[model samples]
Target chain A: MRIKAIQWALSAAVLAMSASAFSAPPTPAMLSNACAGCHGTHGESAGPSMPALAGQSKISIVESMKGFKSGERPSTVMGRLSKGYSDAEFEAMGEFFSRQKPFTTSQTLDRAKVAKGAELHEKNCARCHVENGKEIKDNSPVMAGQWVKYLEIQMADYHSGKRKMFDRKAERMKPLSQSDLDAIAHFYASVK
Target chain B: MTIDRRSFLKMTAGAGAAGVLYGCASTGPSGSTADVMPKTGRRVVVVGGGYGGTIAAKYIRMMDKNIEVVLVERNDHFVSCPFSNLYIGGLMKDLSPLTIRYDKLAANHGIKLLQAEVTGVDAASRTVVTSKGTLKYDHLVLSPGIDFRTEEVKGYDIATTPEVIPHAWKAGPQTVLLRKQLEAMPDGGNVVLSIPLAPFRCPPGPYERTSMIAMFLKQHKPKSKIIVLDANPDIVSKKGLFLKGWKKHYEGIVDYRPAKKVTEVDARSKTVLVEGLEDVRGAVVNLIPPQRAGQIAVAAGLVGADKNWCPVNPTTFESTIHKGIHVIGDACVAGAMPKSGYSANSEAKACATNIVNMMNGREIVDFSGINTCYSFLSAKEAVEVTGVYKVDKEKNTIIAVPGTVGVSPDLSELEAIYAESWLKNILIEMST
Candidate 1:
């Protein structure tokens, strides 16, 4: 009788542990997967045009999704995606993405382009992005390893007024020359 | 510091005679000099010299001169939240313009100002213990302000902060540090600014900072963009104005986002992970985590067990938790009221009046509240919305009265000049 009672107790403990783990769900991993297209493998984006999403607060993230869905927080790409998720799902998505690991980009560029980009980047970009593009970390997108094509698209968009987003910085970027834009994008892509 | 018996008696006689004469003079003309003159020898101790504390201290002197006021602040100087964005944008040369000096408070206003951190408060004892000394009070007012609660963020501490990313909420070194970081970043470098959960000091502050940084980037680094990872779904204040500014100014340059929270920080690899997205990497990261009441608030048993802010009577700004200890500013759970300087100023005035009535054995009247939050779209143009509020018995929170608030749509040249002037006037009103 004692042996049977002990077996039952052990079985109950195992079941309880497994049940709790299962109920928690893998929300962060799921959100991370969905975010990879624009935000890159980690939280790094293709260029300065794409935003970093590594370490934002859960409340801001959830609210932003609701805004995009409701058309309060305006976005060309996110507004559509935001419509697909409910409040609970948005919350879960924010929670999940907020927890995922921040990854460095994999893109690289030639040294000559980097040298030229470095000078221009220092003149205009360093004021907010941090010196050497290495300081002031978290939530801000990493320019390293992002696709050159994606960077080019964003720059052209800013120049041609395709993506009209909120920020004085973006408006300032709209008037750059093609070579200057390419050089800076390549420089950032080579940060890693 | 003790006065002799003879001098005390003489002073008492003079005070009594003056009081009698003043009372008799009240029968004369209305708004007479005697009627407006301050009653003498009343000393008031004001804790926390932020928006609330500064306004209370300055107003006390402005209203009357007889009462002696003492202001205790942890920091030597205060950086204004209103125009800090300009500093980040590189459109301005120095942040010193945003800082208000308290030297004039003592010299011009005759306020006894002390720079010290309050460590403990004894409600029964009616004494406040600071690093310098214990202070007795006729009525005590506290506005200890805010501090971040980092427990929510994994693998992070104060030292690691401002090293990778700077949360320049409190100003001072952090503000300068953040500016330095931005100045050094390459043109196309990745810059991340993490927005913390709601109920933090300055609700629109993080977004404003983001805009300023974007302004800097737009001019110099066309290839660089800002990724805003916010914990809220939408923008809170002057939403339309910010959107308009972003669209017209930033255009395709900004990758704006909301409703995403950043849960962790990987310092070694310089990566930030959003729950549903791939790892976001940054050449630079500004991780703004969650926040709670400052340490002094919690230490005084002002905060609840849930670790949220303390509760207060909306009309009086007195602590619901402890009697004789009023918790003002960002430390209280005043619902629907975003933590801003303007709100704190209004709350402080109401709190001061209530304290005066309590001391004088007069009936305290309940008052309506007011708030105005102005956001400068740039150095030149600004937008604002004002609201008037009263306590709702049904909801137990401050509710807006209908038709009390309206946004400032037209940014006329005259309004722009007024906005700039208002910054200086308000700063003086709070500090002097």
Candidate 2:
């Protein structure tokens, strides 16, 4: 009877493991579906102010989410939303967004501002952003083809100390005026 | 009682003839017959094509293409209430932007669109009787939205006198009517807007409506005033921001009176009677009556002890009363979740996930959702209230996570821009 009891326990343990194995872990697509409501489908936003998340590097997305969750980043809504997810979920979402096609803005840009912003980008941002902010190397998110208005808001946040910026980028941005930032936004948006 | 082959054959023939005759007789004037829908291997029948129902249908198909999803809605097109106030405020020139056709849901997502009213649900048989025909389902999702409790207010019948005192709550023809009344009123005319009690659909909707009407009056008729009779003790949502906006933009134009319950309405005289205060007259009366779960839910006996809203398992949104039936949107009693379009959309996604899991014989996971409701203070500025929620399995209820429930720091044009984006994105998510 003792042997039978032990055998029964062993089978129950095996059954539990098998049951868990049959239930697959949630995929990145599943984890990121909730973000589509405001961020647009596949992380491509339709509005100018809401930033598109498509094709952003995994590290950039994770870092931004961590900042939002920790209150290190000031946001209108993301600060509250970020608290709902875990680091693991954020990683999954980052990986999902990284695999999507990059966003291309349909908004019209000021031609003169774009030209001026190109000079500003080459002077300050191109070192890190690379390829006129089109390259996603060095863990930087793709700035080219991003929404112009959203880029302007981020610059404003950094200027106001509402958002923390890395020391090097902050130093580079400190000398630029608001119009220069606007020009930079136009320059990035003008990219295909 | 055993039957031989010859006797069984006779019985089968007789039954087949009767079945054919019955099928012929049951065909109605609408060219609908009983049990006309062809059965797929696994089918989910979603009634009502509002925010919740459409999302549920589309996501279910997106999650599992093999599972057939049929979306039944009375209206051929969807008119979003989220931005209807803008249409009424004249920020939008027409209702075209607010309206969405169900064609994409059918063509893009492979959802079978049925434009029919659901008359009854036979839970025991797992069949839904609609105006068109009876549809069988492996699972059912009901998101009929809200129906007014018109009986709560004396001398108010929405059916008979919708134009006289337009509630405009449901947004469509009523929205146009309210806009027209505002346009026709004299420059200095007083517009009376009544608010219903709590647990109503869109807690901040009336306040936003008040703001929009105030905007219209302020621009078109400077002397015009809006008398807001709120049934609640105070503003139920984004209280400080709404108050600040009213004070800053519409100091004298918006006369907000809280704790004043609307008891009756004299539609002919265009007067509203308060429980304790004197009767108030208006050039245009926007009386928003109390609401409950939509008629189909009430008829299906899905409502809980409150006899108002349906109760469901927070994780799956499946009806607590019926085994295979799920209820969502404004019809369900979602803990700590306001009855907003965003909430409904969130609930639908969670519900769709579980329904797909259940069909695949997978374990159902817990529920987590986010709700963000944006209210425009003006054409250019808006405020938002958001909450991140998770289910407490022990309590069998959903609770907002700590530090995740908050309103916007202040109203701004930036949020207004986000608000438009939110609507645009959600519509795309739900429809496409």
Candidate 3:
């Protein structure tokens, strides 16, 4: 009886030891779950700083991607991430995100900041960004529900000669101070 | 207070399922198919409850109201590995912020969390076989994270020497184990910390950990010394700030040794055998060995390069090695990107969108992502690394979106405040 018990224990131990030898493969969604750290849930930016990818144009996404991959555009993390995917995947991603609805960015905008921003926007951004920053012309994205923080950062990027844009309208804001840019962003957030 | 809305849902099944579930979906507990919404043909089973898995489960449900989502993880409460260094550094005592209950995610987003160890995967049948039972999935999302390549370190086996020389790489029991060993070690003792090369999760994690340990030693065990045996030539990420930190603060306490690879271990004697240097003995050894894809990823034949890591299409994050299996986290290769929680969370959001679109037969489009990592040099001072990433067609990889990679100008107390805020917001995203 003692011998039998020892043998049984030995077999069970061996089975358990061998069980950890291999692990199953994970899914694509599991692989990509790492992005929620900063981007927010479902690619919706709740932190009021990051851009919302919930609803954006496919062409805009693809063009930005092409720029990143080719080194025409420079990014800290995106350049590395762009190098990870195949070309077809970029088009597919553009389609996927474009199909989703936009996240409503309606955090209470500071009235003073919005008023200051509106003054800046009237002098600089009203050309392409039409009345009240609502209707944007020439494939420009609607800035109404966009994150104020992202807008400020992009403006800084343009001013620093980091990102080059064809829009002459952005050139006017190149001379604005950080406070002015913040005011403009606050105004944009309040538009909707 | 816990609210039971199932009785109310029972009364209002007449309203459109989508409308009734709109914004108020957290009514059921996670786990058991009977408890969650009825399973339709559209279903996704996510493995590993880390940043990637949880984000996928939550986002997929948010995308579609009727799609039943099941998340399988071994642990009940989710622990964040991102801020665990603070806990080890003696700066953070309350561990409540690092952990999140799945009940909130299930109750709020209508997700089913299955606490079980997955045993096997049948790709053809689209079924995940777990210890509890088998589950059929229309789409299988695997965010199993990373596992160490233990065999690389000769004479050190996790099974045998787990207690004496613990590697608290994972954020759970292993972390506490390492902390206890550090606490128990006598003053004037030596701590030998071995760090692996790149493609490992959190390129800057090992350095941050070194700083934390050194900080603890300064406060409690002043005479103790920490020898960092780095496999890389120098500090891999956030170099200037860390080098400055070492010079300004931990100059005498830390013995930084770059280009020294730990090859072997003598657990009984508490010694680590380096490639070029003499065997160094210590009172405590934190050996973070070279890493690879989770064992499950290798077993499913999804791994590449001598079964070291998995290669997936950067677009969909689907395994190039397998038909339908998608791999993420520390398991797969992302070009020019470090495997960090920030990177994982970014990837999870994109992958979730792709999976939902593919399930509904909607068109898949391209999207860019970003990662921002903040490493603390001390309890009050920190630095940062932030960047934007996008898919490159000509290179066929995920690349940066042209000139946005920004490292910190210098370590600052303000950056430390930002770091804590980042952790707080990330925890909120994971839990609620």
* Second chain alone, TM-score for each candidate: 0.85, 0.93, 0.90
Q: Judged by lDDT relative to the true structure, which candidate is superior, 1 or 3?
A: 3
RMSD of each: 24.3, 6.8, 12.8
Question: Where's the lowest-lDDT run of ten residues in candidate 2 chain B?
Answer: B18-27
Best by lDDT: 2
lDDT of 3 by residue, A36-133 (tens): 46555544666655566556666666676777788777543455556545566566666665666777675777889998888888888888788766
Q: After superposition, how far is residue A97 of candidate 1 from its true place, in Å?
A: 54
In order of TM-score, best first, we have 2, 3, 1
Error of 2 at B180 (Å): 0.7
TM-score for predicted model 1 compared with the true structure:
0.61
Identify the leading candidate in terms of TM-score.
2
So what's the TM-score on candidate 3? 0.69
CAPRI-style docking class of model 2 based on DockQ: acceptable
Q: For model 2, report DockQ.
A: 0.32
DockQ (0 to 1) for model 1: 0.01
DockQ score of each predicted structure, in the order shown: 0.01, 0.32, 0.10
Which residues of candidate 2, in runs, are more than 4 Å off? Answer: A1-31, A109-116, A177-179, A190-192, B1-31
- Predicted model with the maximum DockQ: 2
lDDT of 1 by residue, A98-156 (tens): 56555454445778988888887887677755645544443333444445655566566
lDDT of each: 0.63, 0.84, 0.72
